[model samples]
Target: MKKLYYVVIGLFAFAFIAYLFIKKEPLPTYNVDRYYIEGKENEILAKFLLAKDSSVIELDEGHFLLGQSLILDGVNNVTIRGKGIHKTVLSFKGQNKGAEGIRISNAQNITLENLTVEDAKGDNIKVMDTKGIIIRNVQSSWVGKVSEKNGAYAFYPVLCENVTIDGCISIGASDAGIYVGQSQEVTISNNTVFYNVAGIESENSTNVKIFGNEVYENTGGILVFDLPGLTRYGKNIEVFNNKIYNNNIKNYAPEGSIVGQTPSGTGALVLATENVHFHDNVFTNNKTTSIALSSYLLIYEMGKRDAEEEKSPDELGNGVASADKLNDEFLKDKKYNPYNRKIKIGVNSYSNSRWFPTLNNDFGKLLLFKKPFQTIDILWDGVVSPNTDYTICIDNTKDINFYNADLLNDFKNATTNESLYKCR
Candidate 1:
């Protein structure tokens, strides 16, 4: 019996050791490269800072622990390349000086390809006021558990023109993974984004195209928003042929941020943007709704209103006067449009089983209060401008289940009258 017990204990210990060995991720093999930089972090940073126009900086296959951000300012036609996405890693886990991992400002014709940047204090890659930028085959992420202390954006481009981000992988951002704001002529295609608050976001931009992306497991899949105090308004956007599903991750954005208001289980939320189109995208397993078209008033006024200060349905007459007053006060700038107009949804595939809505924030609670029975596929907060011709046009009404939550009427006359919102 003693001999048998000793054999059993030895076998169990050996099995446990083998399991741990198999579970560990193997490191990539490094090839000898004389031309690539394979030294300390300061050496690599110096090469980037001193790079001239039309120069190329190649990184070797190794992990670099960086403490400060790398800046490429006022340089034109620069290219930064690496051995492979998994081979060359730049980690800012102990970052102490700068906010971003890489910052490119006031440059033109910059290209970054084939690398991984992880765990920055702020955004991983922030390109501002640049023209003709290309980011291809790059990966940006935050390691370990997802938290609000992670970076806000992975690939962030703002106030730029002629931007293209293709074949990139982004993960674990507290805010949007791939974000383009106040930029024109942007194309974001062939990317994979997940485990962020919002996977992909286009805010206050024009002439944008988002296609051929797989976006999943975020708080919200995609967002097209026009905020109150921005330099430009969002318009002329197109989203097609993407796979957006299962975006039910809990929102981890910090308090008082605009994206903190986003509810989990939301697939797409279009807020106060015009001339937007959605076609040929596949939506699946979004627990709350597939698509929601909302006015900024719904988020700013009604969503922000304290729940303790409740008004009876009888006290609010049609709810138009309160809404109008709030709109006038919010849209005082006269340049920002507060209503969604000329939006079209055509031929998009939707597959979502009925599930409970999220109760993390006030907006989700409001959605649950409005429709307590089951989930929704397409929801429109029925708030339109009387001055302009606003319409939510759908091509195939029979295939989609639509709900018009009469937010302006305080849910008094909420209906599924799809014919009333037919394409004109």
Candidate 2:
């Protein structure tokens, strides 16, 4: 019995020592507010040589090919600092390109400053479920292209709050240049975003402020959207004092867009967002529509839409309602995304002020003249085929049946019609 007791006691002692080594991290300790992380060589990911603590991790300048992965996990109160912005790169471009440029998950009170990243197959910078994060004076250039699965956006914050992005530059991203989703109290200011689908976009985010951004030359700039099927809603957006112009470029708009060439992440589209305000921005020289807002926010564009064009001159209401009706039929149970390929243009879309010249060419002639642009296609069930004459039935009541002259005439019929509804 005495010998057995000693054996058990010895085993317990060994296990306790093992726990201390495995669980305890190196450097700066847990939750230490101050520390520096440096890369030992340009050819290796020296900054990620060991498990990092919650302190500030400083990376050295020049190209770094990480032999392994650097994970800054649930560590809170951290800062990832490096040399000049766009100076240091983490290139997993070789055989093993990992998940993100700097994948930050579930950490709060973090600051990423004075750094540049490239060649990350996934999101260049991804922050998830984090709060009170700040990204200042940072640049991420040439994040992956759109052809591959992960080669997408430069910065994407999913499920975060109290975020601020200031004085940052992002270029050549497959998705929106800088994006945020499902967050509150967010601010994106003084950033230069270009060569992306949509410059700066937010979805299902509330109390958001996007100001002082030089968002230009992309397909579209500064888009705030909540279409359908997204698990959330977006409202209370304030856009002011920025140069939002020349976003209407030629060719099809990039991905995540809704208008130009099937509404890629094209310029400044707002949907179903309420209590929004846009003022003092220079919107000009864009190839496509300047600002495509919900029918409710049509007042926001003021004089941009010709008074005669808002309502169709046809027998029914404006064409958008027909487009909506057709959209419900085509997409079926899928939440209607105006950016989707079909049903993008309003019925009699050729006459709306937002209509483009090419729309009146071949495809436009077919749609407007009923000429059959190719095979007329429709959606019945979850399949795509040609169905010309089926009546659209909405399983979900969200669809609007406002066809032809319905929206504009009904909206202002009190003045346009004769009899008791005459304008004063």
Candidate 3:
């Protein structure tokens, strides 16, 4: 008994020592004020917010009414957080000079969390030319009903890399509620979006994973597009495990906007993109085509834009070819392929919905004229690549019907051949 007692005591001592060795250190605390009233004396909030590296800027639990925008430029290793999403609100309803409510540019290692921004002239929160960005628990919107006068995008991140947008809410965006463009290595998850033209959009971006998002009551639930005028093309995207429903909002985007072309009640649209996979999503009551596979044929110069349009090397080129070289020697123009490729649609649940898509636009008119007999579940453009051994694959969605508009052939005919796309 004495020997066993000693052994037990030794074991407890060893465990305590191990716990001490493996325990995490306590996080550092700062002595700064939560209200951050440092630069309010001059009424210049931008001066107080010019954060340095390794800085934590916290907004107190209060409403900040600003006439001008808040700009965070060229900052690194900084965190801008609020007391809570509902507790801290930034209203730019009176903004007349600035284009956005909060604009962060040329930033790295930046974090924005627990804040609400609303009613700016342009995007509510725009992050550009950034790397290592994290946005969480943010709400952005317009105060009134959705209209073209509202900002284009609610939570907009373009020309960024390594971005993560989670636990966000958006409403009343004229264009996209959450728009990520010309970005790479992005993950957009756990968000709720409504009352927007396109609820969630990924344009000219690559290596994106959009999952666990709830999108409803928007003009279009989700869109993956590769529009012209961008240097990069979209590819390698995965959308899964999302709730897309009731996206029958009328399209109210301003004329000439890319989203203005999106017809009302569209559940999801994949246009002029590549290597996209959709799986395990719930679709119901969308009131339009549940899922559409299309090309830029209608948008990109009536589908006749040269696939090899060249671009000059500006300062912000894609870094494929060096910009320092003289004009003629290193001017290797990258070929732009606008055709959709390697699309896999699988295992998605669809209901008795989207049978009567709203006839609100020219596309809707054309669709109605071509195939007025029945509503479609999945609408493919019927634009095939020249080197195709069935670039599109569909699996596990046997209950739903399919339609091939053959849009490129002047919308002359349609077909419902499940064998044509069963390459998966």
Candidate 4:
């Protein structure tokens, strides 16, 4: 009787397992939606039009003049899907004036999916003044960067808003891999942008977010800049969860030129902007600082001499702002360049080092530059303080050349406060 009960329980368990197995769905061998289209189609393999001369547009493979700039205009409520990237093609054989693979303007509810745009003398995809824009599984590559020499063209969007960019790949761009300028409420996420002068750039826009993007190996990765007097102020930008690495690119362009190479040498930079958030981003292995924070420094650096008080306040907050001019009469009042600016690394007591003395190999802190800087000050004592002896006096009676000057100048201009008290 006990053995019969045990067999009954085992059979019930087996029957339940078999029922669950029969109810399960098979795992898909493949998802056709994820497949990339390939190969050529009939005709010259030019542009494919959607809903020719209708409010609703649907595309098939054929040589068609696409977008509003071409045969048709006002593409409203359009669903433009490709048969496959291989089946359809955009022939920009003689697109001399700002030709794009798809030039969308003044449209609504626009959807572009599963397309490959190549040989765009300009931008592969250009959207303007559109609402509800969606670009999925899109790949775009330009012939090269177009400047005055090659005609001003790029895979770019200018003066559009409420944009969403995802799962996109852009390469070999002249200006930027992904360029979003003067747009509002935009999101550029999960995109691989590479091999361009500027990786991903947002200029003079607001309420924008850049999240989870791989921006690498560009001349400069992710620049947020406001051109002087452009009338566009970059505000409320958030850059987070992005890997920005190796963003230094050489600029042989002549000084005082903006077009050739984008300025602000940084892996990521925030310049003269406000309400910007930089969080959880990996910035490493760059020529300049991983991130540069600079604002209102220019007003102090280059304010006019006459309006010094108006521009820069004195220590007492009085009108005597020309202490800078007074310094010229007393001592050279020139600002020290970054090379001579005493680079320090790490915190004090824990880890800190002075650059002129030696490679300290630590982060900078307040304790590093508290004393009157002297070469012997760094040599005898690691740092200078009131009680410490001026060690430079023991080494050389004439001068301790501090700032890497030429030997001729060093001998003529050697300074000793004690011996040369009357020289001043």
Candidate 5:
């Protein structure tokens, strides 16, 4: 019995030493000399409200439940950071005032990093009319069931210049996870976006680069769009070196929204944009189409046809005439261009597991009617300006199939001719 007791004591000592050796060291505490905010929710709110120019506000490592939006307006050189992305969380789950969880307007040289913001009533983080912004190592999400009631955008920078969004994760946005609109000189890199209507979208932006991101499981992976009514038209955009796959999520955007018209299983979409380049991207498991190049006229005409069919099944053929009249009306504004021009697709890889396309929206149904047996790798609407030469160039993509839907002629001369789309 004495020998057994001694052996048991030895075993316990050995186990304790092993545990000590293998245990992880505690994370280093944030010790920078700055304005640190902690304690109750109201205290944090008061500190945020007191922030001024050149303020460095450091959030402590705790979850904060705030009632109103945090606004940083007309400040210069402001930095709002936290202990870590997972350690510091700001939730506006019950936000009653303001549309955005965190709103930065008319600011210059702002930086937001190392935090998580979730469940805002509108946009999680909205930066508008600001210049020189950096959003790094941030995470934004909407928890619970994914629905139209979720916010439209996670990280939204609109009408801003010199913006960079890097190393971020965004999820469950009804419209877009990361959206840069009407901005200039933007870089969005190394982000992970999923479960949104659009994973990443650049609308009416110029000199934009989207690279080094993993985008999957959204309704559409990446979109470069120039809408009709926007003052700015997108140009000089490059999308390269990204992994976009499995973007087959159902469309959850609210009715009448532009993104609500996006079909599921879209890997990349270029719509009414000029001088856009896509290269060195890997696309896999996108069920409907890998890359779709569309004109605003085609999308509008199809939507009109769908609506007409819903209202009066006998009025199917009148959509094209109505769409032409609307396009003419939109052309009254000289800045608006309805055709996609100078789109260069270079050296991208694509693989799909499913052969059949999605039939959830009108675009997908059109694809089904065009090709019943197989899915498309690349699709172009074949809508071009009658006065200008608009080209869709494809290089180093001989293995992937291409289709021209001939929307101008109403699919009377749809073709799979690769020679017509060779790079000029």
Candidate 6:
């Protein structure tokens, strides 16, 4: 009798499981309304001019010419997407007053995707003072050959946080193609940047990871920079898996610009930053040094001698107010450090570079005096404090040339200290 009761209970459990497995799933709900707009210029501008929170603006595939910049400011959770990158185009060919093709500011959770922007009066796409923003599958360009008159930055995001820019193309910016300044927690990956002064630039930003990108045919491929008078220092940055080659494009940046200080054919330039890691990257055919390391004093003495602080009072509160003040109060203040230290270069492949450093300025002449046969794969201006030996490690770099120009003492005596830069 007990065995018979157990068999009945097992049958009942199996039947209940079978009933649960046959239940149906609910269909997806489409409650949010999508507002699609196309055609005549004024009507399209009207819709975007007054964008509200949680707004979704879809632009159809076509050529759009606007006289003014399209702005989506002070909005949250807004999505401005196009049908396709190649299908939809926004042109600022006739723009005379606008500063960008699209400018987004003071927002959160903003997503901009699948659009092509060209011929802007200034930057193609710029986002500032925002958080939780995503810029994906976008193409930004200036319509003609690379020129100084072109915009300074293509995809410019400044003072932002938690931003990710992926699958984008930037071309023909006189400054940096993709410039991220004074931001943090950023990821820039899978982008193609070409024909610009600097392909990708990170200035005074922290916790950035740049990888899986193709950067070529620019003056300098990648620049990790820190200028004075900007809020916060740049640290904890990682750059890997990038194809940086043939960055011999002529320097088209206007005179006195920060990028103009960059030598043509530089693969990567790290200036006045700390804790940067470069790993598993390809560097080839660059006419200059494949990798360059220097302090902010190198370029700061070049030409940007304007004593007048560029940042306003509000912006000063955000970043360092003055370069002089930071230097004066160096030890007392932990917020600013203008020295490039603790850089790790690991497992990178470099070939056919350092051909241009021989022709560079006074420092280049000193490098040529050291070794005339081999081009310098890595060039470090040996500018450091005696008390604190900044750690720069280069590990497992095979068959690559290197130079250390001790510029602090007028480049009189230099050292090939291979033992000092061992992998840590």
Question: What is the model-wide C-alpha lDDT for candidate 3?
Answer: 0.76
The numbered model that scores best in TM-score is: 5
Q: Give each model a TM-score.
A: 0.84, 0.59, 0.80, 0.53, 0.85, 0.82
- The residue-by-residue lDDT of candidate 6 on 1-424, one tens digit each, is 9999999999999688545422332211112122323455675677688789999988877777777889888999999999877677887877977789899999999999998888798889999999988999998988755677888889999999998999999888888899999999999999999988899998889999999999998889989987665667788899999999988766767654667767776899998788899999999887668899988666544332433445332322112123334433443555555578788888898888333343433444445557665667788887773434555888874666766777766667676665567775
Query: Cα deviation of 116 in candidate 2 (Å)?
Result: 0.9
Model 4 accuracy (lDDT, Cα): 0.46
Clashing pairs in 5: none
Task: Identify the runs in model 3 with alpha carbons over 4 angstroms from their true place.
Answer: 1-48, 301-334, 353-355, 362-374, 411-413
The TM-score, computed over Cα atoms with residue i paired to residue i, of candidate 2 is 0.59
lDDT per model vs. reference = 0.82, 0.52, 0.76, 0.46, 0.83, 0.77
Task: Give every collision pair in model 1.
Answer: none
lDDT of 3 at 327: 20
Pairs with backbone N, CA or C atoms under 3 Å apart (clashes), candidate 3: none
Cα misplacement distance, residue 110 of candidate 3 (Å): 0.6
lDDT by residue for model 2 (1-424), tens? 9999999999999688546423322211011121223454332344443425567677777655543335566767888887867466555444264667677777888898987766566667888889888998887656333222323567778788899999998765545678888788899999998766568887768788988999876655877765444455566777777776555332223221232222322346565454455555655544334444443222212212322445332322122122232233434635333221111211110112222211312222323233121211111111111332211212212221121112233333212111121112
User: What residue runs in model 4 are displaced by over 4 Å at the alpha carbon?
Assistant: 1-73, 83-94, 143-155, 228-232, 251-265, 295-424
What does the lDDT read for residue 352 in candidate 6?
Answer: 83
Off by over 4 Å in 6: 1-39, 304-335, 353-366, 385-389
Q: Order the numbered candidates by TM-score, best leading.
A: 5, 1, 6, 3, 2, 4
Q: Model 1: residues >4 Å from true position, as ranges?
A: 1-39, 303-332, 361-373
Q: Positional deviation of 260 in candidate 2, in angstroms?
A: 8.9
Candidate 2 lDDT: 0.52
| Consecutive 10-residue window with the lowest summed lDDT within model 4 | 342-351
**Model 3: per-residue lDDT, tens digit, 12-90?**
9968854643344231111211232233422336443666888787777766667778888888988888887768877
How would you encode candidate 5's per-residue C-alpha lDDT over 334-380 as one tens digit per residue?
67887889999899998876656766656666777788767888889
lDDT of 3 at 196: 84
